[model samples]
Target: MDTADAIIVGAGHNGLVAANLLADAGWDVLVLEATPHAGGAVRSGHVTAPGYLSDLFSAFYPLGYASPVIKRLGLGEHGLSWRHAPDVLCHLLPDGRSVTMNRDIEVTAASVEEFAPGDGERWKNAYRDWQDVATPMLDVITSPFPPVRAGLGLAARLRVSGGLRLARRLLLSARELGSELFRGEGAKLLLAGNALHTDLSPEEAGGAVYGWLLAMLGQQAGWPVPVGGAQRLTDALVSRLVSRGGRIVYGVRAERVLVARGRAMGVRSAGGTDWRARRAVLADVPAPSLYLDLVGARHLPPRLVEDLAHFRWDGSTIKIDWALSGPVPWKNPAVGRAGTVHLGADLNGLTRYAAELACGELPTEPFLLAGQMTTADPSRSPDGTESLWAYSHLPFRTAWDAEPVARQAERMEDVLERAAPGFRQLVVARHVAGPADLEREDPSLVGGTVGGGSQAAFQQLFLRPIPGLGRADTPVDRLFLAGSSAHPGGGVHGAPGANAARAAIARDRALTGDLYASAIRAAHRAVYADR
Candidate 1:
């Protein structure tokens, strides 16, 4: 008899989403997580003092707002509640000027006016053109990407005015896009800062796409955070699974997906317990860990092995967290209320950061993506304190010790200090994590490539990770890839996981439970019998 309908590895939001869907369909499901907690990078905790809730990794959730699955699942009823900041984000230039974006198009435009007077009107034009393509643009981005069928579908769906502009937007680098869309330096910096959220420099192609998309989406949905914290989102997902009779085991790692006769059975945890699922095994882990380490080499196709060998992770990131006595007091009062704030010296500074990383050297002036949780929702911290977290891209494989933490963080503080002088005096506590810590906490974060590999033109769309394999499926019949590596890459959307579960369930019906179980025993016996 099948132990469960499906065995899922890693209880990240995607894994949970897949498990919940399977269970709701009346199939028994089991989810196993390596860490002591579920949610992966979406976890939230009080890393500081009592009552100061800090999101350990991701803070902003534009992708979460855009996710079709989140709506379909009705996660809000469980524990997730969203709060939006009036000003979505700000880019603090070295000269103390800032570029801010808000829902009111004219108001946001006025902020752009700081660098150049007429640029505000020009920016409003960009937003109007953006709205024309927003629906289809979202379709192309959120759908299993490079779905030629989907792309063709979108091309047909858009009848709005000037939809052709998205085609042009695709061709420009972030720098080019910013320059063409707005004449204000602050406006250009805001776009560049938004694009860099993907770990790409403004100079990189396709990077600018996010700048416009994120900026526009924020205007539409607002840069929202769950009222309690990011964990509330994860908790809601897990609750749905439990409500459906699904089971989850935290602190459990699946070392391999046992296979036999060219089909998958279930998974064997790193601790040596074999959880047999006679139906299917869906992995919500990274591609490298799932394909090479968990699934083993013999079952994989030769071409797939080659693709795995060449797969690229974006770059490393340095994260700094702080417990502050008060909200970050931005000298410019307007920017103080923004949820997400970016700090950079100049346009050249950003280029240099990317250039150095491309050349395998760390930049002197780092590009920082900082989040002011308390500023947006004061409840995240004590009544008068701020719980803060920030991150920035570093050289792809840089081995950073405590030294770079000081160097990079000092620069970050310098930006804030310039914008809000004496901001350092309010810092009550601090913790900094290098790339190694990020990878150690979650192997999927491999090399701190937060975007689930580069969003580079070469790696995006049908070409992601490798061509012809973006559906969360592999050569192995019952094993599936359900992480950001699959498609609609990164952010908090669980579509990749949902898509994988559907594929696995379909196959489960085709192949008998015993066939899957036998495969697991055989694959496990062959690999582990020697000991």
Candidate 2:
């Protein structure tokens, strides 16, 4: 039996982060990965062609770039180099006009001004608010639930930043926030498009939070990609972990979490091999997989088992990767400079697309979020060629066959073609991954819902992954939930894993370890008491 101080059940970025943090603290850490590779969704490959690299799941890293949690890791020392496009993002309208987000606030302001006079000042004003609260806001989002310290800082800043007003705006739907903030479609489209980066729709409540956060982050720090591919980010985390004496065993699936007397003791792999974790076991899988599958429903509190049944997942995704023979022939050259592009006709078109998905109808006009990898990082493809990919969402658990999935991919291509004429003709090779394919590659992406779980208001903050303290602590002692299913759900940011690592570290401390463990146990008991 293999033994370590901590056993992390997944080699995803989150698990790697937990291992790294623990190893940094001089703890023996072991990571178990079901797949042969390390990255789960944060992976890239030559899927389209030998020379063209494609990000298999997530591509751009705006959150990763903005996240102080990830920032503290200092991944740059581990062969991680970030590359950005000329512009951050471009939202191309059906008529070929594009709204580009640039790192320069003035440039982005000027772009929005083209749609409506005085909008530039308004854009600048919004960015100013972002600058004011950006630090504390991010801290609040990334820190373990209740972010006591960060919350106080945010509150102090919010008083001057229009406390109630800013709070109201954050809870507003993307459409409502856009309508109230910007007078024209350009800024509105930018906000709404950014909101769609999550599973949220234009009209969904609380959509503005992500919309504002991401759009502002784009202006603050351009969406960057690993110099070579998305895998480089994972490689850096793995490298940092190994440097700190962490070990990862790939191709081993964690079948069960061994709990002795309500305390996590070890993990049993699919091959019936038991690996002992002397201190804790952190699961980087989804909530349901961790609680119900690995830990077993029988061991969980009845309420938690019941809550797991209602866990909501974000929308399923259908992604298409293309090895382009040449650059996308965009109708507007400005669109070509952007690493990420939002494809939609207008706000109304986006609403309709969202509505169709909400109604379980296959959208005739899908809203596409696309990436031009070569433009962002030249190493992704040949000199003259472009490595591109686009993705659109479907209603969660939507029934579909291969034929419709193919049609869906074509629809996505059609969306791209409208913005860039002859787009399909530039395709040297193509690869498609339906919901099943994504889940097959990474089971944590349940049904291909990329955000781990839904980002709905009811499931956010303390309510994430079922009602709790929003910390990484589980009902079972010494077992932590260290994935996107935890607080601040979803994104490339390593908060979930970092939180778990912090919790594990706090519980193992000599002076306050008992107190920390007792407090966490009490908190978990209260949270699960009425689940």
Candidate 3:
């Protein structure tokens, strides 16, 4: 039996973040990854062709650059560099017109002004609102739920009435917010398309916040990619962890979490090896997998097990990566300079696309979230060539057979060709990943759902991964859920893991004195009662 102070069940970015922090605190931490590599969804490789590095899963890094946790970790010092394109994003319309988001607020607003005369000023005002609440808002979203200090600070900044207005906006759907705030299709489409980055539709409540926050973040900090490849980010994290005296073992699957007396003791691997954890066990797997599979249902309460059965997963996805011989040859050449492109005619087109997805039908005119990897980071491919990838949400559990998968990839290329006259001609080689393929590659991305679970209003905050206090603490003692399924649901930002580390450290300190442990236990029971 091997022993350590803390054992992390996965080596995803979030899990690695926890390992780094815990190890830095002078605790011996060990990370076990079922896969042969470290990054779960953040890995990169030449799947398409030689000299072309395509991100296997996640690519853009607007949230990552804005993350305070990444700043604190000083990942840049460990050799993580960011590269941004001339434009952050571009949305191409049916009439060949487009709206581009630039890092400069004035430039982005000007793009909106092309569609609606006075919308430029409106766009600026919205950005100004974002500036006013940016710090406190980030604090609120990334911190533990019921973020008292951050909430109070934001409220003070906005005053009573302004704060109320902000809350109401958060509650509105992306469609409602766009209709209420803008007079033209350009601004509305931008927000709605951004909202679709998650599984949420334009009409889904709480969808407006995702759009508003991501758009603003793009304006403040252009959507960036790692300079070399997405793998560099993972490599930097691994380097930092190793420097701090942490160990990571790949190709080791955690079979079960060992529990005794209702507390997690360690984990037993599929290889018949037991790794003991004297302090804590942090699981970066899905909520259902953690509660029902790893820690058997026999250990869980009846009510909790029932709730886990009802846990909703987000929609599936289909991703296509291409090694292009040349640039995307858009009718509007300006689109070529953008790192990301949203392909939808307008808000109406997006609405119809979402409706098709909701009805479990493959969308004919599917909306795409496409990325030009070489544009963002030239090192991703040879000069004058491009590495491109796009993904679209599909109905949950959609059957993906070989023939249908090939047709779907063709449909995606056709859609791109419609916007960029000769997009298909530029494809030298292509790699397609359907929902089943995605799941086979990364189990954390269950059903090809990227955002962990759905980010709908009902599943957010304290209600995420199952209702309770929105902290990372689980029902079992010394076991913490540190994955994206926890609060602050999904992104490359490592807040969930950091929060889990904080909870574990707090619990460890409290247990040193029996009186402190009693108080902590009582408080936890009160908050989690019947939840």
RMSD of each: 4.9, 1.5, 1.6
Residues 1-531, model 2: lDDT tens digits: 999999999988899888999998999999999999998999988888989999999999988988888899999999999999999999999888889899999999999999999999999999988999899999998899879999899999877557788888989999999999899899999999989888888999999999999999999998999898999999999999998889999899999999988789999999799999999999999998999899997677777888888989899999999999999999999988899988866899998998998898788999889999999999999999999998999988834578878889888887887777898888889999998999889888888789989898989988999987778988888899999999989999999999999988887774876666677778767766753
Q: How high a TM-score does candidate 2 get?
A: 0.97
Q: Write the per-residue lDDT of candidate 1 for residues 1-531, one digit (tens) a residue.
A: 227878889888889989988997888898888888888888787776677788888888987877777778998778888987768888877777778888777778888897898898888887777776676666566665445665776677654433466667876788999888877687788777777888677888888787777888876777888888888999999988898899998887778788888778778877678888877788877787888898887887656666677887888888888898987887877777788988765787788878887887666767778888987777898887888878888878735676865687787777667778878999888777778777777767877667677777777666666655356657677777788887767788787887787767666664575565455445434433432
Ranked by TM-score from best down, the candidates are 2, 3, 1
Alpha-carbon runs more than 4 Å astray in model 2: 398-400, 510-518
Measured on C-alpha atoms, candidate 3 has an lDDT of: 0.88
What are the clashing pairs of model 3? none
Candidates' C-alpha lDDT:
0.78, 0.90, 0.88
Answer with 1 or 3, whichever has the higher lDDT. 3
Clashes, model 2 = 0
Model 1 stretches with alpha carbons more than 4 Å out:
145-153, 159-165, 508-531
Q: After superposition, how far is residue 491 of candidate 3 from its true place, in Å?
A: 0.8
